[model samples]
Target chain A: MSSLLNIIVVGLLLGGIYGLVSMGLNLIFGVIRIVNFAQGELVMLGMYGAYVCYLFIGLDPYLSIFIVVPALFLFGVIMQRFILQPLQNEPMMQIFATFGLLLLLQNVVLAVTRGQGYTAPSKLSEFVISVGPLNISVVRLVALVAVTAAALFLSWFVKNTMAGKAIRAVTQDRRAARLMGINVELAFMLTFGAGAALAGLAGTLLAPIYTMSPQIGGNFIMAAFAVVVLGGLGSVWGAYIGGFIIGLIEAFAGYYLDPALKTAIWFLVFIGVLIVKPGGLFGIAGAEEVGLREQN
Target chain B: MSKTDTMSGVTSTRDEGGAVPPGITTFNTELLRIAGIAVALLAVTWVYSGDPFILNIMAQTFLFAAVSLSWNIIGGFGGQFSLGHGVFFAIGAYTTANLYINWQISPWLALIPAAILAALVAVAVSWPTFRLRGPFFSIATIALNEVAFVLANYFGSITGGPRGLTIPFKAGLENMIFTSRFHSVLLMLGFLVVCLIVCAWVFRSRLGYYLQALHLDEDAARATGIRVLQVKLVGMAISAALTGIGGALFAMYLRFIDPPTLLSLPDIGVKFALIALIGGVGTLYGPLAGALLIVPLESQLRAGLSASVPGANLIVLGAILILFALFMKKGIVGLVMQLWDRFGRKSQ
Candidate 1:
């Protein structure tokens, strides 16, 4: 009973991390409609940003979140304006350009740091609280609270805020939104910036939870893709549910089956889901056909 | 075979309903110029540049040219944009490598079956994936490739797992393992020739027109009685099969087979697509240009940067790629064509 409880708690915490990592990706992709292949590299940049603050400025990793989020938002804005916006319609350009950014961000980081990695011990992770037979780390609890709050905040912002409404409006119908006096370009730029900020925020928290490596982004990005696809293409809450489910699967697989095959197991499930539910579980049905099928 | 006469007639026709242009003759001249460049490249190999390292790079370029040429069929012409081309490459390499290792079958014989298997796999995957359009299609393929990689990693008994497999040393044309650099380069050159011929033949056929039509608009093509799924399947099948053969050759060249080396998204998959993109997708000679430029540049950068910063070379390449993606949307061939068009208009 205790072991089962332990798996559930641990799995939930892991799920929160996955959810946080991918929620921004969903937002960027939903509105911007570019896959942002370099999304993982943005997370890597954020972790490095926080790590630098800790190493040089004496800021705690968690505390550096304030700096990381805004800086990354600006970086994302610049990227969108300069790189992504210029070639929006050409999918090849968008795909390869983001891919170029992925290569650039990762390699530039690797070159600058010369592959040196940072690991900061967190006080929160050190504290352990027992819930009946299960002992959970405080850091995991903190992460769960942070991401859940972020999700709720995002949901509310989407429904209530003017900027959020504009973003949603543009996504639904760009030309219609433009006629309604919304700055469609600004919305795209802002959506990308916000998405970057969210990814960066996730990285800052993750840095303390895991060791910082140049390739950490690459490893975790797969899980994020799996979660996003499993949950729904563009839905926020769907990503959360999907993340939790994947985390549970990973935890149970690690304990029950070969731990080495955990990633493979989830990926198999992902492929199966993609084949069976072409529109995803919560995805707007027949979304892929909307833009392409209209002209014909 | 039947397409030769029709291709000759249509070759002079310009784009989109074949509007005859003042620069029609200039376009034919451009095609000749491209042919001349290919001939020159092949001629250079005859000088027998004795530098072992240069020979290795030269041979490697041929492999890349073949892989990218094949990729262009599906990705460039068919507009599928698969990021999982390496999955097929790995399938090919592993099939041949495993057969050679376990059964002692000659790689030359194993190549055909490996290619056929890869084609079948591509067809199977593309059946459901054809429903997806744009980035969603790419994401699905990437996930599937990742699944294959992870499974390959876990299955130690079958795949040699994460430790990877190495081929035992054997020499001679029979084994497809050569003792001389000259022989390796010669084999690769032949492979490149075959790939070029195949690509040229494809562009001259009705299949090419169907692929082009499908890429521009799928529903419209379907309405026009083009089998949208069939053309894409054929394109992917040919692409994967050729890539598989190239993989086998690459493994034989290095005499090693590993997931990171063959299956890595960056090294094989992206590089395959990158070569096509860099040269100019949909252009016959674009992959050749890409391979020629990238193979040498990457090698030089690796040699230069490995001492100090590990990834500085890749950073430079990445920046260049981004610049190309932004500014030079069509690549070197596109730029050249634009210049030629300007000259033709001025002369007329």
Candidate 2:
């Protein structure tokens, strides 16, 4: 029973981080309809940002979130304006561009880091909180709390903000959105920025748990994709729920099976979900055809 | 053009084998041209026979070309845009390497079973993914590749796991290992020839027509009674089998296999796609063109740059890929063809 409880607690905490990372992918895919292959790279970059702040400036990683998130947001906007905008019409080429970004950033980071791993330093990094036979790491609890707050804040932002309404309008139909006098390109840039910021936040949140490396994004990128796919295409809430589901599955599988096979287990579920319902568990029906419908 | 007319046009074009598309010339001339290129390739190999480095590059060029050409079937001709072809490549390598290691079987015999299994796996993957279109399909293939990567590590006992598998070096005709670099390269060239032959054969067949049709538009292909699913499955099978064969050859050459080296993401998977993309997609010899340029450049970069600058080559490659995708969407073959059209032979 204790082990089960431990798994659930661990899974939920891990799920928070997963949700935080995957939300950006969801937002980008929802509005821009481009899978930011470099989102994982962005997360890696954010972790490095935190690493730098701690090592060079002596700022705690959690505290550095203020700087990293906005910095990443600006970087996202620049990427969208310069790189992604021209390739917007060519969906396939956008894949290549994002992949190019991924390669470029990952290699750049590798060169800078010299293929080494570093744990972002923080005083609270190892803090643990005990509650009646269940002891949870305080850092993980913080990650969970922060992400939940972010999700709620994002929901409210999308629901209330004029820019958020404009973004949603563009997602439904780009032509209509443009006709309605919304700055479609600006909306795309904003969405991309938001996605990047969310991914950056995920990086900082996960920094304590995972050792930082150039290859850190590689593991998350695929799992995040799986989460987005399993949760539903273009649904942030679905991604949040899907993240927990995968986290639980991974946790249980890691304990029950050989730890190495946990990713394999959830990916199987991802494949099954794709085969059974390509729309994802939380996605609207017929979302698969939307991408196809765009070109013609 | 009507769908039926397009189908028949592709069919008639195939039957003649002389109908030069936009990039090709007249039938007899094109055949002569191909023969000439083949002779030139052989001459280059023969001239540079003493240079072991050049010889090794040639061997790799042939092997990688074969793999990329196989990928072109599904990615270019069929428009699936798979980024996980390394799974099939790894499947082939593992099957051949394991058979040789565990049972002392010759790699020649092992290639057949490896390709067959890879084909079956391809069919399985295609069935589910064909339902999703565009980047979704590509994403699924990536996910599937990860699943295989993990499993390959998990079942490490049989697979030699992450520790990697090294084939014992022995020189013999049956073992397919040769003392002279020339013979090894020749073997790889022979495989390349087989891939080219199969590729050319399909280029003129019903399968080729259906594949091109599918590439243009899946729903339209289905409307035209092309049996979209069947064509995709068949295309994937052929591509996977050929890729598997290439993997077997690559394993024999390297004499070493590891989970990371075979199909671990960008290393092998993206390498094949990049080759095809750089050369030209949906063209018969594009993979060869890509492999010819990229494989040598990769080696030369390592020889020249990596000691001083670690990530320069990849940064250049990424930049080039982005530039290619944006400006030169059709790739190097298309550029060459456009140049040929402008200056090479105006009166053809």
* lDDT string, candidate 1, A1-296, tens digits: 78888888889999988888888888887777878888888888888888888888878888998999999999999999999998777777788899889888998888777788777655565788877888877877787888788889988888899998998887778888889999988998999999899889988888777877776788767788888778877777877888898899999999899888887789778777777875567778765444333220
Pick the DockQ winner: 1
User: With candidate 1 superimposed using the best TM-score fit, by how many Å does residue A196's alpha carbon deviate from the native?
Assistant: 0.3
**What would the per-residue lDDT of candidate 1 be over residues B93-153, giving only the tens digit for each residue?**
8888899999999999999988998999999988988778988788777776777788788
Q: Estimate each model's TM-score.
A: 0.93, 0.94
- Give me the chain B TM-score of candidate 2: 0.90
Residues B157-179, model 2: lDDT tens digits: 76788898899998887887789
* lDDT scores in order: 0.80, 0.82
Task: Judge the docking of candidate 2 as incorrect, acceptable, medium or high.
Answer: medium
Docking verdict class for candidate 1:
medium
Worst ten in a row by lDDT for model 1 chain A? A287-296
TM-score of chain B of each: 0.89, 0.90
Write one digit per residue (lDDT tens) for candidate 2, span A93-120.
7888888888888888887777789988
Residue A208 of model 1: what lDDT? Answer: 77
